[model samples]
Target: MVDSPRIAIDAMGGDTGLAVMLAGAEAAYRQDGALRFLLVGDEAAIREALTRHAELAEASEILHAPDRIAGEDKPSQAIRRAKTTSMGLAIDAVKTGRAGAAVSAGNTGALMAMAKLALRTIKGIDRPALAALLPTLGNNDVVMLDLGANTDCDARNLIQFAVMGAAYARSALELAQPRVALLNIGTEELKGTDEVRDAAAMLRQADYLPLQFTGFIEGDRMSRGDVDVIVCDGFSGNVALKTIEGTARFVADLLRRAFTSSLRSKIGFLISRPATELLRHHLDPNNHNGAIFLGLNGLVVKSHGSANANGVANAIRLAARLVRDDLTRRISEDLANFDTHKGPEAVTA
Candidate 1:
């Protein structure tokens, strides 16, 4: 009987369609009993899925969207059809105040495009960055942003990202004063490009901010958990994100081969099964399934297009958390300070 925000789901937007979406909703409801859902998709298909998930039916409402945006659809094309697409309708629900947040396991680019158009950027934010909680050695996850949204950014843009990222950490991580850093080739102030250095300088001078700017962080040190939030341009951020994911997979595959290479190795694996199980749980992508489009006037969480039920549920849970935290409002208040510190010229420049 915990009352919480209602979330809008693009039920037809995921790879597995109605069944997976409904299953994810059910799982999320079980995890967070406070959740309510607005399932958007073809009514008949959603109803069919509901038949298989009675618990979700009681906690959900159906909103029919006959059209869907395909994986290959361009953002331009998707935005044009936003009024009819399931993804678009879900975003609209947030803009129209019917839902607190929206979650979609759809085309990343299209979702970004449609969300930017519908939600728009919060005042003083020139762009929105894709941010997510990356598991770190520390007990908590680190916030990394500009995962693939802008590709290229200026000093001002990086500064904006830093502000947005800090706001996110405050909301999602519940940190009163999150330590922030800029990703650089080296830790020295003289290292890295002009944009990163400039962003660092601006952050250092912003005395009014709540977050602590700890200066430059080398790429190699990202997982050490010393920094609470990491800021980078999209190109570098995307590369770093992919490298982490690839490395994780490569290690997993190597472990599998090593464990099965011989009978003695297999025996050792069995003896160490519990430890390996813990490693598996920590490395699982489903545990960190939501990538938030921060800086938008309304919150939108993008699920991995191929995410399974568990992954989708994690995404939905993330959306609900952001809603309850009032992430957008927090970002807006901080963004205003960012503009004040930078002045009109620096912000517009």
Candidate 2:
């Protein structure tokens, strides 16, 4: 077990700058006083921000990082500055054992590049995938992976994603046997590309694994609460994620427009104000703010750049929970089990 895991925050990474980052850290500290922080950014600015949250001040340490990674910076460019940048140093802390995990609301690509370079992938895994918890109609949230980490993935990558995703579901969602599925064009056995079909064939035969392989899941069925984990290449995963987010926003805006269309509609909205408030809370992206880079040697969480303090806190909470649960070890063990069972070779054949 990780003893007293401390989360390293990239204070200068996001769109909201240091204020939101510090506030988010403070909010997380408030929720879990046992949590400690390593604030990485301009020393003077971070010190000034800490003055507002006495509790966080007591539980935190400041690390001076003279530079910051911009949102538009290329991954290659960002990697070059990893040594001096706040986002880079925060991830580096995890690699060096100074921190258990890193949290940043920075460029997703940069974080992925820096993290993969600094910590490297766990053995038996070729590449790391980005996974996030999305609110679903099911009793629990669904975990989806390869959210733009690797645009093109082969059968092996998808298989690795499923194992990592299952481990994450068990660790983060406390699921006993997560039902896993490949995101495909159709649920039929013969549908989807060759890579997906091959992966499915392998997963279907491997009943010995901890996760439940439920076969292919189409795009339309993603939010239906039938599966616990959805695996796909980054290209498809990113497109699906953006589509879902856009749809949510569209629905929310439509409701707003309808509610104030006329005086009668306004009154109706007020009468149903409580219900709408609940809906708003449920649909709020801030409530589900963290996206994790799985299959890495250390933990690194990516918070939405526009997220508020509450969102940042949620991301931090996720990182802390994963650390407490020993997520990295769990994934490693799962991968080892898969390899021992000859999962890859059996699937390929």
Model 1: ten consecutive residues of lowest lDDT: 340-349
- Each model's C-alpha lDDT? 0.90, 0.92
TM-score of 2: 0.97
Per-residue CA lDDT of model 2 for 1-349, tens digit only, reads 7656799999998899899988999999888888989999999998988888777889899999999999999999999999899999999999998999999999999999999999999988888999999988889899999999989888889999999999999988999899999999888899989999989988887787899999988888898899999999999999999999999899889989998999999999999999989988988999989999998999999999999999999999999999999999999888878877885564222
The alpha-carbon deviation from the true structure for residue 256 of candidate 1, after best TM-score superposition, in angstroms, is: 1.3
Task: Quote the lDDT for 160 in model 2.
Answer: 90
Q: Write the per-residue lDDT of candidate 1 for residues 181-228, one digit (tens) a residue.
A: 999999888998998888888888887888999999988899989999
Instruction: List ranges where model 2 is wrong by over 4 Å.
Output: 343-349
Candidates in order, TM-scores: namely 0.97, 0.97
On a 0 to 100 scale, what is the lDDT of residue 144 in model 2? 99
